[model samples]
Target: SQQGEEDPQALSIQEGENATMNCSYKTSINNLQWYRQNSGRGLVHLILIRSNEREKHSGRLRVTLDTSKKSSSLLITASRAADTASYFCATDAYTSGTYKYIFGTGTRLKVLA
Candidate 1:
C-alpha cells in the first residue's frame, strides 16, 4: 500500500506529559502531513512538512522527517486531556500516473486529567 504505518496503535498518558508517534512509509512522497481527529469528528490538520524539510515546530508540536529512512515522527509536548484523539500521517504519492493522498492507519491517544 502507498499509505504509511504508524507505530503504537494506542497510547495512554497523563496530562502535561508528552506524546510521540512515529510513521513509516514505503514509497517516495512529495510531502507528509499530520492530522488529529476527535471522537466522531473530522480530522484537523496539525502540520505539514515537505520532503526537503528535516524538522518543523508549531506551538507544542514538533515534527521530523527523514527521507533517507522514509520515516517521520510527531511529538506533542505538554499534552493535555483535550489532546485525546486519533492521529494520522498522510502523504502525497505518485501512483498509476496520478498523485494521491494516502493516510496511515492511525494512533489513538488518551490523556488523563
Candidate 2:
C-alpha cells in the first residue's frame, strides 16, 4: 500500500536552477528510492538512500533520507528541459521475508528551457 505523500504535487523551475522536492512517509522502511517517469512511461531509478544512510549523490542528483522524520528529499542540480518529468518516491519494506515497494503520489516537475 502506498503511504507516502510528495509535497508541492507540481513544480516548475527554470533551466540551470536546482529543483528540490520532498517525500514524507509513514512506517518503517528498509530503503527509500526516487524515480523519474516521463509521461507515465517506465520509471528511471534516480537514487536509493538506505535507512542507515543520510545522503547519497549520483551525477547531478542528490537524495537525502531522514528516517527520524520519516521523510526524504530529492534535489536535481542544473536542471534541463529533458529533466521534466513526474518524480515518485518508493518505500521498500520487508515483510514475511518478502520485499515490497510502495510508491507514493508523484510530484510533477516541469523544467523550462
Candidate 3:
C-alpha cells in the first residue's frame, strides 16, 4: 500500500508564522508530491521530487525526503491566514503498476487572521 501517514491531523498558527508537517510511507516510491486543498477548491500541486532528490523548495514551501527512512517533511514559511487549508502528501509507485495516488490523512492548517 502506497500510503503516507501524516501526524497531528490538524495545526493552528498565527499569521506570519511557520508550519511544519511530517509524512511517513510504507513502501518504495518513484516520487512524492505535496498538494494543497483550499476548502471546496480542487487540489493544487505544490511540488514533486523524485526519490533521488534529497530536498526541494518552491517559494515559501520546502520539502525534504529521506529514502533511507521512508519519511519526508514539508515546511511552510511566513504562513498567513490565507494559507489556511489542508496539506497532503502523496506517493506514486510506478513499479506497483497503479497510476492512482495514495494520499495521507492530511493536516488541517488554520492560520489565525
CA lDDT scores, all candidates in order: 0.95, 0.93, 0.91
RMSD of each: 1.5, 0.9, 1.7
TM-score of each: 0.93, 0.96, 0.92
Prediction 1 global C-alpha lDDT: 0.95
Task: Show model 3 residue runs off by greater than 4 Å.
Answer: 95-98
Q: How many residue pairs clash in each candidate?
A: 0, 0, 0
- Model 3 CA RMSD to the hidden true structure, in angstroms: 1.7
Better of 1 and 2 by TM-score: 2
lDDT of 2 by residue, 4-45 (tens): 899879999999999999999999888999999999889998
lDDT of 3 by residue, 1-113 (tens): 43999866899999999999999998898899999999958999999989999999999999999999999999999999889999999998564655768999888999998
Q: Worst 10-residue stretch by lDDT in candidate 1?
A: 1-10
> Candidate 2 vs candidate 3: which has greater TM-score?
2
Ordered by lDDT, highest first, the candidates read 1, 2, 3
